[model samples]
Target: MKCSRCDRDAVIFIRYNGEHLCAEHFMEFLESRVKHELRKQVDLKPGDRIVVGTSGGKDSTTTVYLLKKIFSMRRDIEIIAVTIDEGIEGYRDRAIGVLSGYLKKIGVEHRIYRIKERFGKTIDEIAMMDKTLIPCTYCGVFRRSLLNSAARELDADYVATGLNLDDTAQSIIMNFARGDLDRLARLGPHSVVKEDLIPRIQPLRMIPEKEVLLYAILRGIEFYHGTCPYADLALRNQFRKAIDEWEARSPGTRHSIVSVYDELKPLLIERYRNFKLNRCEICGDPTPGRICKACELRLRLDKIQNL
Candidate 1:
């Protein structure tokens, strides 16, 4: 197909906006949206440090690369990459290698945190337990806790993630389905849950997953293309497929869902703003209750091991 904007052959056809773009225009569109999100959500200053949660996937690779490109001349702003090793044998090991190589190529500082070292067990070990929990239940709670703690330790102004439009839409649907209004309130481009927790920024929340992958390929950005073995067992996989089908049927369905959530998020936040927060007595992390989800899971795992 012919490019909608220029004479070059079109590489992608965005159904929602009805724009058929070539590689150059597509890259421009993706980057411009991300830049807009960053400016709108994150108030970055001259010397602000951003800790990027990179998993060597297409989304994360694109996030770090784009942030660097946008702030290339701003020497005062520092970007560091942090990868969590959940100890998922073949998957995480290969991803770490890709992450290391990419960061080194771009000359960005990076760090890796292993679950076993910090939590006394790897994801594989936790999965083997005779518990009634899904792998993602444990993995999600622990990984998020580790990232938040790492961000605080690094003294970063913001912890940036690679969550795209699909991810955000799925999360909104999931939270609403489960009647998790608190979680739903926290589902915007930036988080403001607690003072101790470094706020998170999602610059790619406006972009789709397919566009992120295409952007990485067109830019020659290298990433681990493998899927996690345990991903099929998560509820998110189901949501992802359903959302993809909806997007296929109605080109802008995903964007509409996220847009609605974005519009309601501020009101939800204000309504829940005065909700009390406390520190987890065990880990000292902020939690709605006396104990955090990570601590609760850790205690459960420890009990199972003892049994």
Candidate 2:
């Protein structure tokens, strides 16, 4: 099929929109939406620093790449790529190498933090220590903690993530299904800035996962394609599978999920607007509870080691 916008052959047919786009139009289609999303998420000023939680995957690589491209002329805006090393041995180790090289090649400053460094054990070790909790249970808490700490340490104005439409939709449905209304309200791209917790920005929040992968390939962005060794055990897997099935059965299902959530999120946030955040007594991160979830998990790990 010919390109929807030009004579070139269509590289991919977008089922959600029913458009056949070539390499040029596909990249443009992706970038333009990201630019719109980014603009809606933040109002950048001179010297405003943005830290991206890059995982060396297609989504993250595209996020960093596009952010750099969009703001290339804005010399005053500083963009840094931060990678979390969850210490999954060959998996995370190899990703950081690819991430580092990519960041270097793109002229973006890069940094890496490890879960083992501050938490006293790698994710791999923690998984072995506790067989009851899923690897993602530990990983999710540790990664969020480390990423926030990394942002605070760097004094960033905003923390960027690579969450795409699929991830966004799954999270919304999962939280709604579990009756986690507050968490549902708190999903990013975040607009509010909380102390010690850098608000997250997701440029790819509206983009689909497959589109991101194709864009990365077409743009020649180097990214690690390895799956996590413990991925099969994630609680999110069930949600992801369900959402994927829905999307396959109904084109634009993901978009409909996010769009409806977006419409409802304002009311959700307003309902919880007055709920206060308390500092984690141990780590001082912001949380609605007395102790942050990360510290709570860490305390559990400590008790396990003592036992």
Candidate 3:
């Protein structure tokens, strides 16, 4: 196909908007949106540090790459990449090898925190010990908790993540489906900060997953291509498949879902504004109830072990 904007052969067909873009234009299209997203998500300041929760995957590597690309000239703003090692040996170990090399090649400072180091168990061990809940239940809670703690220890002003549009849409529908309005209201690219809990910023929240992959490839970005062995066990898999089907049927469905959610987010936030977060008595993390979800899962794991 001919490039929609130039004479070069098109490298991608942006189905959502019906544009056939060549490599040059495609990269420009993707990076420009990411740059815009960064600007819209947070207001950067001198000496402000951003800690990125990088997982060495396409999305995360792209996130760290683009963040450095955009802020490379700003000596005052610091960007550090942090990876969570969930102790999924075959999965996380290989990815970390790629992640560390990539981050170093890009000259971005990288740090790693392990779930087992903090919680006394890895995701794989939790999966083997507990049969009722999925590994994702433990992995998600532990990963989020570790990321927040890592960000705090690094003294970061904001924590950026690699949540692209597909992930964002899936989360929205999943939360809405489960009647988790409180969680939906508190979804990422967070502008408001709660004490001890770092606000999240998503630079690729508006970009599609395929585009992120293609951009990573085109830019010669090195990221781990493996999926977690336990990925299929996630409750989110159902929503992800359904949303993919919806998006395939209707080119713009993903955008529509996110756009609608973005429109209603302010109202959702306002409705829940009065609700206050209490520190978890066990771990001192922020939560609505007396205990946070991570600590709750840890206690569950401990009980299972005792039995």
Candidate 4:
């Protein structure tokens, strides 16, 4: 079938929205969404060093590709890629090779921080040591803490990630359902504005996961195709599948979900404004409670190992 946007033969059908996107139009559509989100969330200033948390996966690789394109139009901002190696044997090692090659080919400055070397424990090691902790959970906790530390080490003014629309929407629903207004308030395209927080920026906040994959494929960007071996066992996977099903049945359901968050953003912000954030007693990072989540998990692991 011909795409309605380009009147060309469509490569794939976005069933949720019944929109046909030709190869070129598909890229354009995804790029436009990225650009809109970036321009909206990031107040880029001259000489801003933006570090992207690139994984060797489709989402992150596509993020690097688009960020490069977007920043090229404005020469004032400097961009670099910072990859966190979670020390997941073949998974991270192989992906880093592709990521490094892509960054080298694109002439983007990049660096990888090996978590095993830094933390003395790989995510898999930690997960295996503690049956209660899931692999992705451990990986996520370590990655966030390490990403912030790496961003600071790289002298980055802002840290950008490849979190897409579905991830953000699912997080929103989870936060709201749990009455986590503070987290919900901080759920915009821009990560955190607090002085102690390493500003997290999501450029592809409005793009879908499928669109990201399609863009990577269409652009011939080299990205790891397989899921993280530990991802299937994750509780987040259930939320992901549920959202995928909803989006499948109701085209644009994910977009609508995000839109509701956007519409209610002011209220969320106001409500969470008085949530009383204090510096984490352990890590000196921003936290709604006494200790930051990352440090708390790390301490728990430490106690477990010591015991």
Clashes of each: 0, 0, 0, 1
Instruction: Put down candidate 1 lDDT per residue, 5-35, tens digits, no spaces.
Output: 9999999999899999999999999888988
Candidate 3 TM-score, C-alpha based: 0.99
- Pairs that collide, model 3: none
The local distance difference test score of each candidate is 0.89, 0.91, 0.93, 0.82
TM per prediction: 0.98, 0.98, 0.99, 0.93
Question: Candidate 2's residue-wise lDDT over 1-307, tens digit each?
Answer: 9999999999999998899999999999989999999889999999999999999999988899999999999999999999999999999999888889989999999999988998888999999999788879989989998998899899999999999999999999999999998899889877876566688999999999999999999889999999999999988889999999999999999999999999998898889888788888887778889888888888998898899
Give candidate 4's root-mean-square deviation (CA, Å).
1.9
User: Candidates sorted by lDDT, descending order?
Assistant: 3, 2, 1, 4
lDDT of 3: 0.93
Among these predictions, the greatest TM-score belongs to 3
Number of the top candidate by lDDT? 3
Candidate 1: how large is its RMSD?
1.1
* Candidate 4 local lDDT, 1-307, one digit each (tens): 9987877899878765678889988788778878888877878889899889999888888888888988887788888888999988878888888889888998889888877776678887887888876877778777887888888887888888988888888898778777877778786565447665668888888888878887888899888876677877876767788888887787888888988889898877776666667888987876778997888887887898999
Candidate 3 off by > 4 Å: none
